[model samples]
Target: MKDDNLGDSLEYTTGAEAMGDGLSRARTSFGKQPVLGILALVASMALSIGIIGLLDAELFATWVTFFVVICVPVHIVISMAWELNYPSFSRKLKQPLKGAFFMALMLLVAAAIAVTVHYAQPIHAGPPTPFVLMYVIFCVLVTFWFVIVWNCWPLSSLLDNRLLLGLGILAVAYGGGYGLFTLLFDFDAMSAAPFYSAAMDPGGAFPAFHVLAYSVTTVSVVFFCLLFDFWPITLFPILRAQPLMGLVSTIYILGLSAAVYWMGVEWLDMEPVKLMVNVSIGFLFGSLIPLIMFEGKLFGNLRQPWKGIAQCAVAVIAAVTLPSIYWELAPLVSGPLNSGAPGYQYEFWMASALLAMTFPIMVVVGKFLDFWPLRFAPIR
Candidate 1:
């Protein structure tokens, strides 16, 4: 009787294994999470609205930005944790939520640095220190909340492996790009070489110019890298949800940069151009680059040599020409108008035309300099 029972149990276990495999194959082809999990996301947004409504007007806006910069990831983590720990939600929700939670954590560290600076400087007129502190605290709370969510929603075996690989690749690419740029180029290599050197010396340059230029440039670089990498981890949902998602995403990014710029400049009295450039740089580096990278190919084998060459060409041209564009345009709009207001008008149009012309220049440059070993001279 004991031997018969053992054989029966083994047969049941084998059957369950076969069933699991079949379900997973179906999920892979369909590529969506359980519908209920998406509803939970809507509920989370409603909760977020309640929280924001409690804050004062100025604080409310900051709260909204905090939610945007921080909370979405928290929502994902919460869902993941729920599904992981309880094993109740559809397994599809678990992986993306987990990835989002991790990303939120990374952004938290970056935000902490930003907040720290916000407090240290007497930059804003009305004492923005309190607002910055609240933002930081909220971010930390959200991170922990997501940790709980991650505990709840355990991912399927397939998703767990994929998430790990995706994160690893992103980390390697970011560090590698930053390291390469720092090592290869000196302050003299950039158009804003003087500004770069000034930033390092005993006393930094004026706050406005520094903030504007550095912020935008940093943003620009990040986004540009992201675009080139073509990470479908972010792209999959995007492609599915909206037909014009790319344009929408680009506009959203650019608008966010502009708003951040306006705040740094108009509110905090930073130089407009400097703030714009820095914000642009940050967007370019963080999101734009990654978007460009991931746009065309989904699950395609990575291209080599030419990919790196194209990135180099774009980066170099952008760094040199963008500043020149800014420098040439500034005087026309702001400088005292003499008899040649018309000439200034012409210069404005000419600069715009030149900036537009750089697209073809990029193509030409790519052809000539795309090869390795500094054919004549490197882009820097």
Candidate 2:
């Protein structure tokens, strides 16, 4: 009986292997063409550049800036999809496709977001309703795509280029630039509005708000892949090879902050430095908290990025709210310095000190709880 069961199991396994091989061959054939993928990417880039020029000719000149900020992310995604979907796309064109496709898709997504925002009614410089829904759909689809590809044919096992760096740079530049432009150009725009909409102000209307959404999407996917251990880049050799993890994480955090502050200034229509002190305090402390706890582990695993993110969000909230509470109660505490010019200085120091204390505590708590079983959980 045992021998019969073993024979049956072997036959089933062989059938499954054959089926998988057939599917892989089909994907490989599709990938080998490169023309379909190439055309799609190029079309996307052309559309993005045209829109940017149309939106604001003076602020943006030539195609270089647009290429870097607008074309890059689209290229990354398109390339990633094609490369990872390989044997379906030509390996010879894989790396080139990554750069090309990223640029093109980035443009397409940017254009789409802009169109959505431009036509939509403004609720204080926020993302258009359609874009928001589309953004969600895009994320879900990409995420699903990522999972299927990773399981079916892991790209990390094959490709090892600087593709991610290009992706990161583009994501940061465009996302950050869009926010800065919005802040400087529009007042009464919600501080968080650009994050949702990406670009609200006409000055930075080319790629628009949804562009940031796309950047977030790409980053999330890459990060998710790393989290699942599909990526050797997330580990030791890559860690030392260029500190890619640190660089990406730091850029993302800082870039996002700049974008947020830029929006806040615009939404409130305040001066460049109106909230300078407050924002600086928050940034300094907020940045530190992550460094303290997840410094080396920032991209240690896939979940580390998200975990660091959660910590950063918590820090920002605490930084903003806690300071307000402290300021309000300062008078009641009744210290000699509380009423003088030095009082402001004292308050600043106090807040900074408080933030300093809070970060390590968060790390410790995180370590103790292991992020509540989410740490060991699989990406799925």
lDDT, residue 87, model 2: 31
Stretches > 4 Å off in candidate 2: 1-240, 243-254, 271-274, 283-302, 333-380
lDDT of 2 by residue, 294-324 (tens): 3223343446446546545644664577556
- In model 1, state the lDDT of residue 129: 27
Model 1, residue 377: displacement in angstroms?
52
Clash count, candidate 1: 76
Off by over 4 Å in 1: 1-57, 63-204, 222-299, 305-380
TM-score of model number 2 = 0.25
In model 2, the worst 10-residue window by lDDT is 2-11
Residues 1-380, model 1: lDDT tens digits: 11111101100121113225342222331122222222322333334333433544344333334334332222223222221222223233323353344345535644654454354443433333222322333233223221221111122212344344223323332333333323332323233432233332222233323332433343443334333432332345653222233344445545655666567767988544434433443233223121122222222344533453454454455445544544454344334322222123323222222221222122112111111011222233
Model 1: weakest 10-residue lDDT segment is: 2-11
TM-score of each: 0.28, 0.25
The model with the greatest lDDT is 2
**Candidate 1's error at 71, in angstroms?**
8.1
Instruction: List lDDT for all candidates, in order.
Output: 0.32, 0.34
TM-score for candidate 1: 0.28
Backbone N/Cα/C clashes per model: 76, 22
